[model samples]
Target: MMWPLSICVLSFTFLMILALSLVSMGFYFVMNDLVYFIEWEVLSLNSGNIVMTFLFDWMSLIFMGFVLFISSLVIFYSDEYMAGDLNINRFIILVLMFVLSMMFLIISPNLISILLGWDGLGLVSYLLVIYYQNVKSFNAGMLTALSNRIGDVALLMAIAWMLNFGSWNYIFYLDCASHSFEMTMIGALVVLAAMTKSAQIPFSSWLPAAMAAPTPVSALVHSSTLVTAGVYLLIRFNALLVGSYHGSILLLFAGLTMFMAGLGANFEFDLKKIIALSTLSQLGLMMSILAMGFPKLAFFHLLTHALFKALLFMCAGAIIHNMKDSQDIRFMGGLVKHMPLTSLCFNLSNLALCGAPFLAGFYSKDLILEIVSLSYMNYFSFMLYFVSTGLTVCYSLRLVYYAMSGEFNTFSLHPLNDEGWIMLRGMLPLAFMAVMGGCMLSWVLFPTPDMICLPLYLKTLALSVSILGGWLGYELSQGRLSFNLWVLRNQFLTSFFGSMWFLPFLSTYGVSFGPLNLGGSVMKSFDHGWSELVGAQGLYNFFMLNSKITQSWQNSELKTYLISFILWIIIIMCLVVF
Candidate 1:
């Protein structure tokens, strides 16, 4: 009998093998500078070839490899996390489909083919988000799907616009026609798609709402698949935005998104949402760097962020599982005493998230911050960058303080040991990668070290902000800081900051409120009111009333018939005499 656990094991092994093979191929491609384009002509139309194209370069190959690697581990982790689930097999299948969609997205240079993968991602993610079969999950899934639908539509428009160029293969036009008017439209459309899919600014409400998914799915999503799709798309189409105003717009939104997520994370108590916000923050960083015309740095950070974010989610999953499905951090305290190994991994990933010295995040984040300083930028953008970085550290330490430092806040005899070896096995690999992945990627991606010359104060600024943020985080979490008291007093201000500036309500309610009210009014006035009075029912009533009157005349007494006969005879006689 093939149990679901066995199926998961088999899938994990197969994916691991493929991941290694692809990663090695990617390295070889990078070392030898090779790119292979495989195209199949699926159809032929007037003046166009509907060809399915696959691009295999170092970027695509390595991204595909990392995605598969993380997905395999997540699936393996789910075997333990979802052990008692009756539909674990279905869950595994959904995950595999998601991976396939991501692969299609990564390899396609053609707009049509990219749409296939893009829609696939949006569809599968909706399925996964609604997997729990609850109202909250359903709403979250709808928001996720509809939000990505905007991007899907934008991509379709892009594909249609590319028709003017006589080719759907964007790679061909990206270099030669980058500055043309058509390219500008395409670039703007593409950026809109990326922004929605990546959850920048107004579109950010869906990322946290999607925590209605199971924890393992959250790990996969935040790590490598759904959210990163947009960033990867931008990385591929970066040439289109070069020297364009679109990049500047993207930079502003991404910076605000980064700052918003970090600030909201400090106020978040749900474990998964805090991590989700962190993912959003990192995505903003990636987009901001990419907008500044550093796609390679963005890619570098993307890879490194994937490693630790997955591990962080897995640790949260384990903690939530052991806590009997509780995710509120207030209920978690002194967990380090009970689950030491899990605590170690959690804190390590947290510090990595903070860009602590020599960790996986340090290499990419430090480079990015220094480069931002070195770049020609205004004061506002600069402050946004550094302040967002500090807020990241602040929230991270606050989470640490609340969840791991205080006295036990829950039941006395709860089982909290790190006994789930399978979950631990899944996390251990990511832990190792989270420690060393940055340095390795730094060497591989940048063979020649970037010459970053900065003044001493600027060099030390990142460290200073990080230190101050951590201190503030710890102090505020303890509820002893003056800032905390001020925050408590200002309910409205606190609510605004805590709610992502009420983005979820605006996205969900504000957007829907008007349309919903209009719908209700239409229903009341038309369907049930005027429509009922003048439509089929009204016609039927009119005919019925006339029919009843005619029936009464037909059934009139004999005297009425006699009177009618006498009047007719009198009129005929008078006409004859005349």
Candidate 2:
């Protein structure tokens, strides 16, 4: 505990200094975006342009700074949360490596160079996800790693296709390649790659499963850095994605991702998983808005979501740790009585998540709703966005009811004190930010988009949905939940949402099984049977047999001559007829 605690303090200090440096860089880059390259060709080939290029625009500067800030705070928080574990050192190292990978991913301009950061993120996240070494942890880690591997492969293919353009500096070509068939293909692939990492729609199962990890890793990786990588990629390449078919499809998929996760959260019970689904829901909101051509808004939401979401998870981690590893909200009623501070942080973050006005989440979420409303969109997009907005409030209120506001559900003799000041100290700053970061960032990052001409009804639709959702959650969750016959009759619907619409099953087995079966067939028919038979030995045997037959025909005996004449006559007749 002493050594781990000391290292955590040192790491926090170092990160704070780095964050200061990034803050100055952020201010400098605001007026003008800067790109720098250290160029000395490492290879002799004409195409081996292995230069380390970095883009230090406002986006990367602000994002990387926020990542460091959250990471340092998370490490400080983990000092108490993970203090009892035997491998605390390993956990801390993994967390720091995860942060480094995210930083590397944020800065690199070249696709090939970006792979260094991308693959590092995947490998380190897998290590962090499986930190506990249990069966569930192992399985979840594999799903997380493999699902992300799909994105890695997509990125590699995109790189290969990009090689045709003579350089991998995609940032240089985004404006030029707006409608290039090759760039369009790369753009489509980039979206797919982003989806898997961010856990959008069909590829979303690994996110909740990844909660099998320790909670700090969840707070750091899922909340701020790893999941937002996809959003950042689109933000970086917004020039190419705008007005493309791929962007439209991204909108549809993102809406479903948002709506499905919100629906899933309403049915979920695990405290960590509930938060995980909420992260998924917010991620969907970001992607959907980005699809609607508001990349800046998406990036804004991504940052704000990170603030409260990380705090939310930290509160969950504290509660879970204090509750002796119990995670089910069904067994956690009246926790506000025992852990008031932690409960306060949890509720505030939850409210922010619900888009309560003036909080961090409200700024970004409210702006997204307004801009999305202004757009000319299909009925499906409108329904998905507004209904999903309502669902966010619904699930958040339900979580509050079950976990914080009722009779105590744990043992009467349990000592349910606030764990200590150490935990609360880490949470207090985030709580402050979660409350105010949105208002602060709105002025700094974006010009308040002009909305003076909008109708009153349009402006309040999101808030209306949120209120309706809260009322429904408060009313429906309190009484006769299991006994509701409409719910009983619609067990299939309940089960479907409860299972995250079976996305895990589809992402894993549905994608893998057919290809694996076909591979087996190909190996057997080609490797062992046909290729063996027709390859070197079979061809040699046929030519040698023909050589022997020809030699026999030319032996100059009477029988040989008669046989050759007969064979020639038969061959000539067959040629004439056919």
Candidate 3:
């Protein structure tokens, strides 16, 4: 039954991909007639004007291909992982629903349709997260659902604002782009929506928590579904978001997210949680590069990140499966001896993740760094770029060290070899792609040889950082030196660029010096006066006093009702007299 169902799902996915590819090709040849491919409805106010439209441009096609390809891999991998699970049927359904929602989102014709798909993805993702129905998984799902609702509200508000301005369609909105201020505000709100969805900054805590989901679900969500939605949203609105103050804000946020996430990954002990943080960091890098006005680089990085990250996560799942579902790296060591194929796949994916030269991650990530370096044309942004790259190397090595390089810790329960032919077969292609995907970029996206020049220095720096970080990690694992503790303690330094717990309160109310400070005196007086007026408890006492007064009035219910009726009658009489 499982085998047949798996075959059916793959067939459906392939057919869908083929159909979309043909449609995309048709749009390319009949570019002038692209509107015909979209489902358009005439606006009531304008007989000939359509209210909704979808353009099958180069960008959408590329993203569509990514969605289809990654979804295919996820479904294929799930076949073996979910083989004996009784709820496998529901799992397959949710997978299909999730993929369908993403397809709709990518080709959405208007804000309404985009939001429809957005909400659908969120709904399915929450279900997938809590599939095990365990307490921790439920908690993670609830948090994700709540955060996603915040984003949904922001999106709906933006859509409402746009509708009030009488332009809900992208074409009309773009045509009237001269209202840069209004567009900028909408863009900012949309960025908020994207930030929450992508797990950026304050909203980022939800993602690592989300690792409570099944590994395959985590792979899909992290790689191509929920987290990447933000970058895709920003890319879709590139015209409005680019060249504005909001763009700069996004760039800074993205850079900060990348740095902090990388640092967090280094500090984490759970293997899945570390990869989850890495996903957040890589998504941040993609968004930052997109903010630099290089959509192609962003898209390219998105593609590469999906391939390697999913492969790594699935391999981790295989490891967990073999080790009786143990997720702690402390118990995992020298499994490379037993699961050599899985280890090799995992290592190759990590190499790509570390952006080693000629690998998939190297091409895409180096391109982003190169673009930022050239376009910033300033020493500060350049330095920021360099530091971010170095941190990326650090965390990628941390992931490798904690998982694959430790001494084989003997256990009462011995780990097994690879799961089966199905799991190994599913992982093989991802490993191959991780190794060779970079070479395909030139032929697929950029045919210009000049655009393909390697960033020799950046690659060298990344390789050096990876080697040093890995060596240091290994030594620390073996307790060669006591210095790694200091580095671990200083993890907060990497995240300091974005911490605001103290600053917001301090800025909102004037900062105070000593007891003699004017600001301190003013605050003290204000506190005293408030305490005297409302009593020691302040607002709670005031609310209690009000409640007592109301209770006293309500104690005489008959009298109170008579008085209320009289007032109402008098009000009605006064209206009649007027």
Question: lDDT per prediction?
Answer: 0.93, 0.87, 0.74
Model 3 lDDT tens row, 127-170: 99899899988977887887788899999988977765676655
- Alpha carbon deviation, residue 220, candidate 1 (Å): 0.4
TM-score of each: 0.91, 0.89, 0.79
Give the clashing residue pairs of candidate 3, or none. none
Candidate 2, residues 65-113: lDDT per residue as tens digits?
A: 8899889989988888888887777888888989988888998888987
Candidate numbers, best TM-score first, in rank order: 1, 2, 3
User: C-alpha displacement of 306 in model 3, angstroms?
Assistant: 1.2
lDDT comparing candidate 3 with the true structure: 0.74
- The alpha-carbon root-mean-square deviation between model 3 and the true structure, to one decimal in Å, is 8.1
Q: Which sections of candidate 1 miss by over 4 Å?
A: 1-5, 43-49, 519-578
